[model samples]
Target: MATLSPEMPKSDDRKSSKDVVAKLNYVGEMHDRAVYDIRNPAGSNIVWDTRDVTIHDVRPHLDKFTMDTQGFAFVKLPSKFAENPELFEGNRKARHFVTDDSLDVQYAQEICDYIQNMTGARDVFPRLGGLVMRTSTRASAEKAAWAPPAEFVHLDFAPQAMQGWIDKTLAAKPRDLKPYSRVQLFQAWRCISPGPQDNTLAICDGDTVSSDDKVIVDSMTGDPSIPGNRWDSRMCHYSPDHRWYYMPDMEPDDLVLFKGYDSDVPDAMNAMHSAFQNPLGQTGVPRKSIEARILAFYD
Candidate 1:
């Protein structure tokens, strides 16, 4: 059973303190299992539960959060779109992402290069299919066929699922794959919208989460008729020990990189994150964001 925190901040402190109090959805204990249908939420049948918790602003403690320690890191990475917004304006649309355009391909390569430089990896592979745009509003999400900001606390992939991805990726290569000393999967997220986002992502400190706290759930995406649309992800049961942090009023240039799996380290930190409503209340601009998955190999 998950223990509830007795030190939950008061309503006044939540608004005035450095930390913000917000509601985060987690897997309910009532259900022995759960399944999330990403394409069709109406078809999802499971318990959806929420809890009010304090989320600390990470800016002041940026040095403490690193991929090697807390499983996530925040950095200032200027995008080419920022330098010349007009040139790549069309690339923002979901339709352009359907078939990789030259602009999209360039942007993807930029991300790959950045990751390789940051991690000092032998190589970095960007999963083009993993690139996605999300919005906080329903209308934008529906219009673009883009996913909404996920409101639940969960990690992207389980260990077995990550291994499966590694296998498939290697098998598709034209040449034989070489053995690697280490492998790490990462998700890079950035807010494309304006600052003071009404909804921002909150990540739990990996060190605070216990193995038993995670519950494997099926994530179903794409067409229901497809056979390979499902994969295993991890959802959490509430634990008072969980420490959550978020970057408040993030700008377009700010990028967050979090790890999903690590092959070398035992009990490696895996960032568990969710989008939460801002305790300070809504801003004029809703949250618009993009995320990509990248795999890094170290020899």
Candidate 2:
């Protein structure tokens, strides 16, 4: 059961018994764990980047990592990694996400070049024939009872943004791939709630707006009928076309290659969706309910 919110009384929670009903006029659902998007930093209501809060991932040695002025932070693997695995294991960060516009273009290009080199596609960029990303989705990955299943790992891939990136890459021509001289990228997100379509979100009610604004794919995971998060409860990532879709659950720093070019992947994703049918009977990932009582009860 959700803890009562401090914002208001239990009986006057107004929207739902599970909600706290903050003083804000909106009668939206509420729950500390009832998921929301973190794309806009305001979600946390906490200022500063990841460093502002020292909850987890605090550093004993700041010198071992690199954080430039643009807020692009990452650590390169040294040649001595194989020779000294114990010391070099912890300081590495895989994805140096370009979170700020004012960052230097050279830094982004440098990181991209490093990624290309690591992918074993040495000359694909800088004067490239082209770049291609083939994608595939594995449905019901949670059903398998593997001893090391992916319940704990971050669900880092969102489907909508992934499609957006796919569209972006396909439109570009085989231009001379100079180091990105004008590094500009548009960011947007849609707060998708699961509905009739598979993996696609329906606008809450009467909303019709979309743009380069950051999107919040408010995803639901695990079995939908169940009240709480199950083994598969998670949020995924979607990018237009980035070097690493996501690293595997292997080592802390081992960036695994995702198969982004397979044509049959999208069809497989639709087959498992819980539409029309009730989620209680669904065998795999549960569907979020739209019933007035079920939907708005949890924020």
For every candidate in turn, the CA RMSD to the true structure comes to 7.1, 23.5
Model 1: residue 286 alpha-carbon error in angstroms:
1.1
Write model 2 residue lDDT over 50-136, tens digit each, in one string.
111111111122122111111111222212122232211211111112222313222224434443443333233211111111111
Q: In terms of lDDT, which candidate is strongest?
A: 1
- lDDT for every model? 0.70, 0.20
**lDDT of candidate 1 over 30-67, digit per residue (tens):** 55557888778886766867899999977666646557
Q: Model 2: how far is 259 from its true place, Å?
A: 10
TM-score, candidate 1, is: 0.83
The estimated TM-scores of all candidates read: 0.83, 0.23
lDDT of 1 at 158: 82
**Which regions in candidate 1 have their CA more than 4 angstroms from the true location?**
1-18, 30-32, 82-101, 138-145, 170-176, 224-228, 266-269
Query: Model 2 reaches what TM-score against the true structure?
Result: 0.23
